[model samples]
Target: MTRPFPDDDSATLAAHLRRQAEEHRAKYVRAQSDRADKFVTSPRRVYELIRAGIRRGTMPHDQTLSEQHLIESLGATRNAVRKALQMLAEDGVLVRARRAGTSVVHDIVAVHDGEVGPRAWAGTPDEGRLTVDTLEISRISAPAVLQRLLGADTDSVLLLEQLGRMGGQPLYLRVGYCMTDATAEEFSQLIESNHTEFPPISVVHERLFGSAYGGSDYVVEAISCQERAAELLDMPVGAPVLLRELITRNSAGAPSELSYTHFRADRVAIVGSTLATTAASP
Candidate 1:
């Protein structure tokens, strides 16, 4: 044995052995990954779990979720918890501030039946709810936002401005914009007829496109009331208002209408629903 290994240098042998060890270790790591697919959960799934808990009211609003708590409870790594919290904060689901523990913000409303916008505003005829007054309907130059949102090739868009009221007091202002279509005029009439009814836009979609209701995405943000919005909503120009943007699509997956509604904080409460498992923040 000594005679056979006499020519082999120790450094050379060590390098060869190290290389083989690395190769085997790499193979073992890959094999572990393949075998652990069923056992390992992704960061995204952890995020969904937390979000669903918040939306479903399992996690109380304003309740802080600590990293250590989540790690111990969910069997998640520090990196996964951090990423999930970051995403939720970005989506306005959680408030993450310096020195402040992450907490849920919105009050989850179980909207089991209809879109929040139409349903919240719609009241029974006998209930003496808010009245919607159509202020103006005009054709205007398409804003960049509208063009991008609606995928509109034209430069013009139809705008409908309305004010919601209760007992002669202005409650909220709704400004609706739609991509130009041949049926716009007729649709406009229908909207005008039911402006006060708080009819869901789905009805309009069905009449205009001859298709069923698709769906909508809503964004809720705090905005300072501008002069136009202030006047329409009958609030001070600098007052804070809840701005809800509704982006509704057609059956063909094309954006059909966009609505910017300014709600008085004291007058209305917006309610939204979530799925049993997960919900994307507005």
Candidate 2:
């Protein structure tokens, strides 16, 4: 006698599995789209809206969105959106809570990026108005990583770390290195004279070298905050941070300065402007 096989509706079973998988995928897409809608207009506009919402208590205190949300909302590429958020966060416009999400910071803080020229600091003299206080200036041996920026022998380059503040809060931590003894001596003297204020480093370079420092040939990358950076910025270790490596050259194109700047990611926003218009004569 042949053994009888139990009824197995293989086609129906496969159809059921396929339907479940599709349902799961649709749910994921909807969730992702909703998250992206929360933060994806122009990045600055998104931030401003969030700030306004927070002030009005419209945005729930416990609910927050991520940079990915902003990217998806704006329909921008991930890298572009991430860069914008990182810059804004570094400038202190948004608070990135650990494992929670990014939120608008209630406090007032601003980072001003100005060209190095005669009128760079014009119309800004008061403490909070300018946000230009020098926090620390110390001579230390250059770290191997920083040595590469200086393009000088690691054993010879002098490292100077300057911490800056705005409204009595840390703003940026900069590590500047130089091989020129004159530049080092002048910087030391300048730091001594202005114990409370920070003139733009580019301005100082111009005064010493007889010309403005050239645009940096360097890179800016994102990294997790280190212990020291976290402490200085009043954030937790492993917080998101911005790392800028700048190599400045003199008039003759010789490497004159190497600097690395780390910016706090919850108290500032870096604003850039561009002009666009429709042509009337086309």
Candidate 3:
């Protein structure tokens, strides 16, 4: 049995790989330096859509919007529709009553993009300051994993990839997937027109599906970067990275989109806030 290389070959190969990764990262960053100004995420589109319905008399005043009706009409999950309703209610566009359900409070209220808080888009206040650049958009057959995750009956999907930055320094790479059917063309057009400034997948779901902007369920893991992920994050292949898989679902617990975001270990840090719980009475 002949050996593939000398005993020290493995160490040599590792060094070469690291060098290659560094070189690739340097080249990518340099090329993207001349990019234009970026923007933050918003769910203005969904808010507008519902507002239009109200003003157009399509959703008349005092009409209740049930969860099932919104899901079917807008293709959004219950949670997203609910959030939109809540935002509308706050703006005096709609109202929620315990026994009466959600009803239109007024005919029209213009809720602009920046008017909403961080909670509207499942992001922290700090994240609203980060710049985003659209990197890639494509249409492809839904992979088995996505099919299972999204519960999509269709075979096709729209994919959007973006890079987040702060002070012109790269931070993270986010990839999003949504099932294709009626919104395929709309998704494609939005990606083409507003890739960098486009809302996050959760907001996109509400806008496209006419659902409220619900948050996502995230699964975090520390994994070695493979070739594609390394290229996206400008990290060396095999370097340790943080992977966050998000499944954005509606109020009924049905998924609307699936996303996998990669963060360079050196460039990103994760922090969160939790509420304090009071002790139960004995």
1-282, model 2: which lDDT tens digit per residue? 642333486777678779999999999999988866653435565546555444344544444556566555456556655555565567556557677767655443334433111112434422333334344444566678666656656555556676666556666777767655554566677655444343565666665455666655656578899998789777789987767666778656777667777766554444335589888995
lDDT of 3 by residue, 100-133 (tens): 8998764432212211211213253334445666
Candidate 1 whole-model C-alpha lDDT, 0 to 1? 0.69
- When sorted by lDDT, best at the front, the candidate numbers are 1, 3, 2
**Candidate 1 lDDT tens digits, 153-216:** 6688778787776546666788878665645566667765655455555775775446776787
Model 3 steric clash pairs: 74-209, 78-251, 79-250, 79-251, 80-211, 80-212, 80-213, 81-211, 81-212
Roughly what TM-score does model 3 have, to 2 decimal places? Answer: 0.46
Clashing pairs for model 1 are none
Q: How close is candidate 2 to the true structure, as a TM-score?
A: 0.51
Worst 10 residues of 2 by lDDT: 111-120
Candidate 2 vs candidate 3: the lDDT winner is 3
Worst 10 residues of 1 by lDDT: 109-118
List runs of model 2 lying over 4 Å from the truth: 1-120, 124-148, 152-155, 183-186, 192-202, 208-211, 270-282
